[model samples]
Target chain A: MNKDRPDRTPESEERRAVLGKMASATFAGLMLSGVLAHAQDAAPQKTLIPARPFKVSSDANQDVLIRMQGELERAMQKPINERRWGMVIDMRKCIGCHSCTVGCVMENKLPPGVVYRPVIDEEKGTYPNVTRTFLPRPCMHCEDPPCTPACPVGATYKRADGIVVVDYDVCIGCRYCLTACPYQARTFDFGEHWTDNAAKGADGALALTAARAYQNPPNFEYGKHWERGEGIIPKSPVGNARKCTFCTHRLDQGMLPMCVSTCVGRATFFGDLNDPKSLVSELAGAPNASVLKPEAGTHPNVYYLN
Target chain B: MTRNTKILWALWIILALMGGIGIFERLTMGERLAAYTSYVPWGMWVAAYIYFIGLSAGAFLLSSLVYVFGVHKLERIAKLALFVAAITLVMSLLTIWFDLGHMERNYEVFTRPQFHSMMAWMVWLYSAYFALLLGELYYALRRDVKNLSPREIQEDDRKLKRLATIGIPLAIAFHGGVGALFGTVSSRPFWHSSIYPIMFLVGALLSGGALMTFIVSVIWPEKDEAWLDLLQFLGKIVLGFLLFDLLLEWAEYSIPLWYGVGPEADLVKFVLFGPFWYVHWIVHILFGVAIPVYLLTWKRDARSIGIASALVAVTFFAIRLNLVIPGLVTPELRGLEHAYVDPIGNRLSYHYIPSFFEWQVLMGVVALGLALFYFGQRYLPLMQTLNNREVSK
Candidate 1:
């Protein structure tokens, strides 16, 4: 094992203390049971110690990301259909920085006029009594999704894991699904570009070339490389109906969604709902947890903790 | 050609040329030039489509009066009406085809149709109706195809009658299905009503009958007493339907406006008093209904009736426009429009007005329809019986 560095932070000290407590507890249990007595006598210097890859905190709420990461890895071992993906956003912790929204756009390479998630800023009451609230709206990935049935070509459907996905290749871009969604989660890509109105080489070719280069890279959505094309007969996702997929491509790679990872206040949590110990399942089980437009009867998998 | 015919040709050419530029832009730019955003998904093209399809259904149903019900006074224009129906159906299909994001994949609706979707059902119904229309049109023209025995003529007439009987219900189903397409979208309260299918039928009859009356009064070759009498009969039918249609409109508008509280009420108020209020007040109420009602009731002459019918037929587009756009202007969730702003694309906005490109494409559709009508009238036996009557006279 590598030696502990001298330059230690308070968080590292807390983690080391937690680890030491766990080690002592395990040693006491093993001594009482006499399971490791023979091994301890043979190799007194080397006791069988458990491997702890993630930093442990004494307070359960302090290392939520680390806990959630562990849960995600455990859930990934299950079959795809058995794992029901879910999300929970704690609105009290959200500062409305819009970092999650920006992260989603960057992660998916969303074009202009198309968005997967947007935080709604609403002001309630009037004058002195007014209070502002932020509600981040993403695709509910409903159990009974209305948008899926509205697809005339059977292009959009709910996966076995409860994620609603659009088959970009099969989508006819009718925009019927856009109207069908009560939450207005779906948006059609009008095949627009950031540099559509920018002057060609106005400040020399550097800015224009860089912008083009940024747009040229293929986005890995649904585990497929999608290179956005220009002109009338646009590429698939450009004309297809798009919505949030809970970052399924990332989830498959044992990584959390971009929005969940980028949330500064740790407001967003994502994991398999089938696992009762998952962070999302725990948050969603709370009495304050609810969904937007419950009257729509969509039975959304995404929950918001008020 | 007459001076009127020459003027009509010049107008057609001008419209086609203007629309060509818009069509070119649409083909090259995709939906970039369209004013409709993700918020207001349907726009002028959708309205135009319903308008043209209503005309087709109405014209076909009018022809049913001649073939199925044996209304001999309407016999002279029955074939002409069928031709008009077929032409308008083509125009509606073309207009809607351009509205599709993947126009090439339209065949997928047939190959991989999801029956739960009303749009898929409507497309299937339209295909069935299109085939039935062709069959009916062929039988109606078979007697006039060349020299034929009297027995062959009688046999063709029987086939025509049978086809018309089949077509009447088919026309109602497809047109009513169009209304149901909007009606079944329970998300939009304005369109979610049982009355929509009936309203669409009434509107079709009024608009389609007016167009037929206008053609008979103004464009028919013969100007004898028989022609005048037929025009008067068509005028009375159109006027009755117009009044009935108004009563339905009143029911549609007033029932929701009485409370002025729900989502449907807000949409109704928006259609009446919104920024585009003139579309309903000046275009539809004034030109489409009031002026036509006044002329049809007061003057009663062939010239006056012709003008009235023309006004009603042309301004019915405003009625269609009101039906489609207002249902979509309001956001489903409050403040959702302000939540995400697409400054560069301007496609996240709730507000929508048909762009110049949209109107230009519509104008092109109308021009194409006019061209088709002209060619069909010139070459087909649409007016064979009427010409034979004139020759004998």
Candidate 2:
């Protein structure tokens, strides 16, 4: 045995690993405590303000609710640091045939009553000089999403990757998000299916692959849910809050969402928005493109080219 | 079991039948019953959600008179208010769930909290408010049990007291936060007003107080003490909230009209006077505000109070609708296709109608609330007025 070498006992190795973990945890905790303590010390000091002449503050000042809710406004100003997922729709190019709506339905397999996409037809001008325009709509996935705040459980969130997603299992069936959404872009899966009869091969068609479902899936680095029939079984039914995920299941396989792939006009494009080299980047920079419902402050992902 | 039971049952049955229609529209026609399309994703369900939200806020405000104001004479009605608040919250949530396309992934609220999202604030606010209500309820009950011997108390008095105390401040936080849910939106002109939260709070108090008069009368408190005082207290609360709500509305309404509002802001105006004018007229002004004010505070007998309350329950849900739906229906741009969103951020939910299955689920939730109220009132120590059954003229 080399004199420089320490003991070869298994217990020492175990102890070393344990010590290493403890050191890392302690470091993290110390850093966290320092941050919290600093924040506490830096709490905003209250300042006196002039009272309104006629307005009665009453107990209804709502200072508490407002103070507690400051985080939301803070979020509104959180600054889209990373390539904030955005979209550009060219209003001039839309042909109102309901192709996007039809394609979305065929791709997403939404229950009847629920349309993942739609062609909004607008009649402009009056009398003989009237003109009509069709605007296709999808979730804006707002930078300051109204829907996200309404969720009681915080089941939905925006990913660093720039997509808004919902975690199905934890949703308590409260649809606050539905009401909170100003875009009216969301849908509720009211627990209804193709049919209520559960036993009659009632697996309900998996829209991921159609043909009732897909099979013989390959493992992808992301979402790994390659097989349509072999995807991870979520504890939710079709009736839960379901919306578009930009085909994350497909994105994992280096593919685009079904709707994007099948767009008859090749109107939709998909890619990592952060990389300036990406096609969406070039399109976003192009002056002819615009996004739907940009006024809602929900930075959407779907762009349109006129 | 009795004729009274039969009457309540009939009311329930009628309610169920109405809800059944919503369910049918939801399941069969999908976006058929209502014109909810992806371009206009929300419809009746969003309106219903807002309505229930008003009711919940109103109910909570009513409960606060007894809790925060130290008016324990109004105490007997407080628990019922709390229960009603809980029930209406469930109804509001059910409405939203039925409106979403991927109601399946509605989980994101809990798993993901968007600090910036007004929707997220609502989720947290409601949760915290629920907690607060539960806390105050326990506190209200705690002293009663404490004064009595250990044998006379229920199983978990200590924990109950702790929880109830926690709920007191939470109720205020909850409704205010709910107001902020809409107020935080800079896009929709109607919702963008800073006074919206204040409007919501006053509206809650107004509706809650109005509801209490009716609920108190229905129970037919034959021998309860301070019946007169309770009625008087409720009148004041209702009048206060109503005036406040009206003033806020005046400010909210005139501001946009005065300004050369953008296309989105004009949409709110459209909702108020255009296709949705009826809702503004019948639901918001007449049924929600004016009718209840007249019924609750008018020089009338106890029966009028009950009817007024039942009406308040009806109209408060309506007021919530006025708040939620109108803002949403207004297009984000001058012209856009999708009006609503589904759970997974899909544009499809904008066109949802409550299916029959959705209605069944909603009915199930409502039934559950009713059952809870019935059983809680019957078996639990819900009311101090239980022993005194008569409301003297």
Candidate 3:
């Protein structure tokens, strides 16, 4: 054997491959940390500007809700069409905490059969090296929504300001739109209460009272206060297909979407995409930004950052 | 009453009682008792609705052959077919109306319908068809409606034939429109095919013809030599439609699955080999197609053909189930089936099994149909017409 090369075995080659993968993964982690650091640095300066006449100077380094709330107020002053509302969700920052889901439920007074936003948890790889990923899904509100045309009753449609809405009063509850959706974002209202069966058992009366109070409150969805109840002709949502509207009624009051304000990771961004200086515009215009199911040709306004 | 009649009455009473409970639940509780959720909205009722509608279309078309095309051999049963068609049409409308979120708002289709939807078009076409069907049935029964003399009988026949002529187009349009309703849904990859409408038409012919054959053989008042001849002809026609329907089904299933690709491929495989694979293999192919085809071809008699046709009629519901459920069972997005879980409400998950309450409602609809048929047989001169024919001979 030539002594020039010392101990170059097949085992060494296997080790080399494993080492290479580890190096790449570490480099990727470092790159993500850099991006997060940059985001933190840029946030405070944007928050310092006086967004409204009655508002005091908000610290740029304040919570993401305050920054986004300011952005929402500025966008509301523009004409509706000139305001192309969009959302940007950064996948890297999401903690899978489900705060957004809970916040949405509370804000909408969601009944048992209805859910406006849900956190999807996906686990990748197999054993020890496995990592978990969380994707919180809301309605895409597509520019060319497949759901709208599929509705025989013309109950659901896309607004000029880029929010898709369902007219509960007009909806016949045919559920054709539910099947048409590629994202599976829509759910039907089956007119159930959380404390339905509890009312028949021990300590059930108190639970029932709490449920009725929580459930019957006026939910300002689509700018109308809806007191959901069970009747011969139940209200709009009770017999209709429902989905996320980006909290349109809240937007009318110059507030950010419930999900955007409630995200624990501050991963969600919301503002008019038309406004070049808006936080959502900057994030959505980034190269990493992408939409779900691009092959579907839905042209969704919701963008995701990896 | 004979043994068969006694058994039928017993069945009707039991079903009616059960169905009453379902009706009560539907009236008081609304859609809360049903197993189908927002994810899988349509269930057994929607399938039953299409099944009854298809049967009505098929029976009406068979009647058209005798009245419009002047098939003298099938003339004796022409009135019978029209009556069966009308009953089935009523049942279909009732089932679908019950399926509606707001049954009272069904009149909205007539008032505020948007023409772009195939559903709207289907409803309109069927309403027209329903009108034509009533008109045709009335004319067919004109001899019994009045104490008509022989000359008047001839006049009634002319009116009946004219009404049947108008009914031919109405039947075709409404039935084919039902197919188009499913076919035009481009979002549903499983249903969005040109052949769906055609498949529905052929299926209607097979199932409807078989049902009529069963009814005629078992219930015909005259078991004379002519009755045997009538049964033989009806049996042959049913066999022909069944074979044609099978051919269309082959084209429907095979073409989509040939390459083992496309969104439809997995869904078709699920129908053929999934958890409910028996619905297609055992219920549809074995009982509906194979056994019936064998009996018709080999037995070549009224009794055998009647039994075979009845089997085909009952098993044909499996085909309708396969068409409706599988189209909706699969989640449009991957992982959606597991995204949200609702164990009690049954509205969150994509997986669907029709609740027992749903079955009860269906039973009620069937009992209603049977009761209607029973009353029609007793009060109407349906059986007397055959005695008159014998007397004339």
Sorted by DockQ (best first), the order is 1, 3, 2
Model 3 lDDT per residue over B1-393, tens place: 899879977888899999999988886777888888887878898889989999999999888987788887777777778888889999999888777665556676667667676777788888988898888887677666676677766676677788778777777778888888778766678888898778888888888999999998988888999889989999999999999989988888999899999889999999999999999999999999899999999997888999999999999999998998998887776666666666459588777898999999999899888888878877776545534533533
Ranking by lDDT: 1, 3, 2
Best by TM-score: 1
In CAPRI terms, where does candidate 3 land?
Answer: acceptable
**Candidate 1 lDDT score relative to the true structure:** 0.86
Candidate 3 at residue B69, lDDT?
Answer: 89
Give DockQ for candidates 1 onward, in order: 0.59, 0.12, 0.30
Q: Per-residue lDDT for B164-254 in model 2, tens only?
A: 4555456556667767766765655667667876777677677766766666766634534467667666665666677677888777777
Error of 2 at A283 (Å): 5.4
Task: Please give the TM-score of chain B in predicted model 2.
Answer: 0.77
Q: Which ten residues in a row have the lowest lDDT in candidate 3 chain A?
A: A36-45
Candidate no. 1 TM-score = 0.90
Worst lDDT window (10 residues) for model 2 chain A? Answer: A225-234
Scored by lDDT, the top model is: 1
Note each model's CA RMSD in angstroms: 5.8, 20.4, 10.9
| Tens digit per residue, CA lDDT, model 3, A49-137 | 34552363233445556656767788888889888889999999999898988899899988776887787888889999899888888
